[model samples]
Target: MIGVNDILSPGMIVAHPDRPDWGDGQVQSSIGSRITVNFREAGKQVIDGDRVALQLLSAD
Candidate 1:
């Protein structure tokens, strides 16, 4: 399981299992291992917090 810290910067895309195939948005910020993302789905602000929905396109 990779975290925000593993990410380089925002605007990066990551696919979450529970979430949409494109829900993954740019990384807003990296708090320790927590990654805050600007979830934008059809111009809608989605809440992206813990439970980052494993099985996502993480940065390896």
Candidate 2:
């Protein structure tokens, strides 16, 4: 199934829907359902696009 994360790409800023404490994160990479993000507080994290719909903060 298609998801919002399917539109995410590198350089985009996003926030974890569940982990607000993680702070805003930058899209490092997105391949298939795997998304790598570098958060201000959580550091690098691998998120499953199929599971978590990251909230878009900035397109650039």
Candidate 3:
């Protein structure tokens, strides 16, 4: 498990496998075991529904 400090904040890029094409995203919220991500798609930032019950990708 990774601490909140381990994960970067909003505007920070992250890797999300669910969005393989867009592979990068800006953090929106981190709560419990889930992290909300907003990915840039077609020149627009949209909420990615890949947040629920996800594992942290941080190196502990």
Candidate 4:
């Protein structure tokens, strides 16, 4: 299980498990239980860190 302690930060890339429409997103901000991601397709979206398990994506 991913938690806030997993060390998420700005510029990190991630994918939403249930929101493919949003496409890949770059982490913009992480504060407490809220995470802001700027996606390719869906623009900026604020996700609940406690409720969503975001998949970390590699730049490679």
Candidate 5:
């Protein structure tokens, strides 16, 4: 599970842990356990932080 410190904020860059096809993503929002990311290839998606730990690429 991702802690509050580990939680990413808006405009942060990230990548999917399991889906390379999803490509690079930009974090839209991180609220509680819900994270919204807009991917370069796969578009925007809402991820459950409790279930999948997203890899942070860079800060906003």
Candidate 6:
């Protein structure tokens, strides 16, 4: 099944569902279930899309 992360592309804005302190993040790259994001407050983070469902903030 296609998950939300599966549709996420680079440049899309997102937020960590569990780490609100990480603040908003921009999708740098997404490969399979691995997603690399640069957070506003936490810097770069490689999130496991299979484990975390990042909330979509903006597609543009």
lDDT of 3 by residue, 4-45 (tens): 334555555655555556545567765444556665552333
- lDDT measured at residue 24 in model 2 versus the true structure, 0 to 100: 100
Position 35, candidate 5: lDDT? 92
lDDT of 6 by residue, 1-60 (tens): 777799999999999999999999999999989999999999999999999999999999
The true-structure Cα RMSD of candidate 5 reads 2.1
What tens-digit string does per-residue lDDT give for candidate 1 at 1-60?
764435445555554456574465655565554665655562323334465542335453
**TM-scores for all candidates?**
0.46, 0.94, 0.46, 0.84, 0.87, 0.95
Q: Per-residue error at 36 for model 2, in Å?
A: 0.1
lDDT of 5 by residue, 1-60 (tens): 535326689988998889989999999988887899999999999988888788888886
Of 3 and 5, the candidate ahead on TM-score is: 5
**Alpha carbon lDDT at 18, candidate 5:** 93
lDDT comparing candidate 6 with the true structure: 0.95
TM-score of 1: 0.46
lDDT of 4 by residue, 23-57 (tens): 99999988887899999999999999888978888
- Candidate 1 lDDT for residue 37: 62
Q: Model-by-model lDDT, in order?
A: 0.51, 0.96, 0.49, 0.84, 0.85, 0.95
Best candidate (score: TM-score): 6
Q: Count the backbone clashes (under 3 Å) in each candidate.
A: 2, 0, 0, 0, 0, 0
Q: Which ranges of candidate 2 are over 4 A from the true structure?
A: none
Query: Candidate 2 on 1-60: residue-level lDDT in tens?
Result: 766699999999999999999999999999999999999999999999989999999999
